[model samples]
Target: MDARAEHDSDTRAVSRAVSELARRTRFPIAFGGLAQGGAIHVSSIVGARTRSLDGLVVQETRGLGGRAFAEKRPRLALDYRTSRSITHDYDGQVLSEGIATLFAVPVLVSGRSRGVLYCGSWGQAGVGDVVARPAFAVAEELATELRVGEEVRRRLATMPPPATSDAMAPAMQEELRESFAELRSIASTVTDTAVRERLTKLEQRLAALSRPAGPAAEFDVRLSPRELDVLACAALGATNAEIAAELNLREGTVKSYLQSAMGKLEASTRHAAVAKARRAGILP
Candidate 1:
């Protein structure tokens, strides 16, 4: 999708998240923004006067959302109108909406803050952990989706355009094979299962695209999911113990996966297995 469409879709998801958070947290208003440049530009809001928050911008470290964005953590203010915990740069707009208590949850992806989610009450209702917990859950879900969306856009940008004629040029065909291999490797690092599955299917479709019109290669290199997971890390030069720690598996299990992958690739050593897999378009 183009940038505007992508942002529109993300805004819809953000709307649903804020609405649910407002319902669960008993907050009268919920609003938030994705990080852009040095500020968080509020993009979605619920239960608020649109003029008060619509398109509001919070500079880094200048407001509750700013503090949370800079610190990469949650920031809270009970009685925000009179609180000194955060800068009062946005107080006029916030007070216009009669908001008192506010919570800002930073949406983190791969340990970096990408956005903020705000839950607020018009009264000094004191939103405690009871509300913050579920609000953070929604933030986590948003972070996951944003990360996948980033990956999809980044990868697809480099993909070859549709063939004008019936045939793909030889150079483009080889590039597609390499990209398919990279996609499989990328899938191994994705924490979201559905995103990983989508990447796997993309890799398969690319593999099919690279084939001749007649029957393709009879030998389809089949590797188990675990095997792919283990080798993808090993290809990055991760040690067995490191791989085990990263994958949350026992050291023995890591070794077992390595051995299985080597056997399936018909390679006698771990390095050989990695090289063989790369040649077979099983690794980037």
Candidate 2:
């Protein structure tokens, strides 16, 4: 994808993250935007009661969201109107929305702040682990999406166009496999339905790109998501323990999934199972 497409994807990701934040934390309002020119330009909002948050631009260290961005961590103002720790730069917009309490979490990627997500309520609400954990998960999911996009774009830039022959270059095939595995890993961890669906589509595209230039192999087997995840990691030569750790499953569970996948593919070993999956277009 080009720079414009990448920007649009990033924006969509931020929008989804904000929506998920609102749903997960049960906040009355949620909004956020990606960093541009060293500031968070609010672009997406959910559950807002008015137009007060529209077009809101938050500068680093200037407000609640800004402080989160500057510190690369979450910040909260229990009483927005009388908060002494943060500047009231966006109070006109925030207060106008009747948000008495506010929380901000920065989308940190690669140790740098990429943007900020804000959740607010009409009344003061204590942000305990229940609320904070999901907020952090949403931010981390968005960060993972951003990081994956960057890696894919960088690899594509260095890669040559596909050849006319049926076979792909060994190095190009390896890169595609790596990207496919990474996308699967991310998809397994993502909770938002829309984001997960988008990742699934990307995974399909990568698999299609890596297929040989001929009629696709006709196969009737369907592997479950966890089975696919385990297979993808195995394709990268990861052992059962490594796949277990990466997928956050027990080693026995990973082995079970692998064995099930192997049976579905009628393969006697994990290596054979991976090869069969690739041939069946079940993997990249």
Candidate 3:
């Protein structure tokens, strides 16, 4: 995808995360945005009574959100109007929304801050473990989405265009298989339903890339998610033990998944199962 399309996709992920933050924490107000040009430009908001938060841009070291972004940690203002620890650069917009207390969490991906998320209330409320946990979870979820997108884009950049002939280059096929396995590994750990769905779509795209030319084949087999995950890892020449370690599954469990997938694909061996899956357009 182009840069503009990528940006829009990231923004949509952030917007969904902000909405989830509000729903999970029961916060009356939630708004957040991704970093661009060293600033967090607020792009998503929920449960706000006014347009004060619209077009809000937070720079590093400038306000509560900025401090959280710069420090790569969560910051809380039990009393927003009287907080001395943070600068009041955005108070005009913040206070206008009657947000008496605010909590800011930086969306950190691979140890770098990609964005900041904020949840607020109309009354003074201390952010204990109960309120803080869901906000952190939401930020982590968004961070995972950003991380996956970055990896996908990086892989796409290095990949060659689709082949005209029936056979793809061996190196290109290996890269696609690796990408498919990595995406499946990441998808296994994601808890959010929407994010998992997005990852699944990306997985499908990767699978379609290596699809055989000409009319599609008719296959009656359907592999479970775990079965597909095991098969994808196996396609990368990963041993059952190695797949277990990567997927946090027991060695026997990994074997079981692989055997199940092979049975479904009507293959006699793991290698055969992977080959059949690729031919069926089930793995990239």
Which candidate achieves the best TM-score against the true structure? 3
What TM-score, over all chains together, does every model reach? 0.64, 0.86, 0.95
lDDT tens readout by residue for model 2, 1-284: 88799989899888888989999999889999988997899989999999999999999888999999999889999999999999999889999999999999999988999999999899999999989999999999999888878877876777665565767788888888887887788778767676677778878888988876677778799999999999999999999999999999999999999999999999999999988888888888
Worst 10 residues of 1 by lDDT: 210-219
List per-prediction Cα lDDT, in the order shown.
0.76, 0.89, 0.91
Model 1 lDDT per residue over 1-284, tens place: 79898888677767766777787787878988787898888888888864778779899888888999889999989889778888999987888888888899998987998888999887787666788888887887777667656765666676676575667766566566545544555455655454456567766666566444564423356889778778867876779998787777899998999999998888898899977776665654
lDDT of 3: 0.91
lDDT of 3 at 22: 97
**Ranking of all predicted structures according to TM-score, beginning with the best and ending with the worst:** 3, 2, 1
- Listed per candidate, the RMSD to the true structure in angstroms reads 5.6, 2.6, 1.5
**Which digits, one per residue and each the tens of the lDDT, describe model 3 over residues 1-284?**
89999999999999999999999999899999999998999999999999999999999878999999999999999999999999999999999999999999999999999899999999998888888999999999999999999998888788776465778787788888888899999889899888899899889988998788775566678999999998899998899899999999999999999999989888999999888887888888
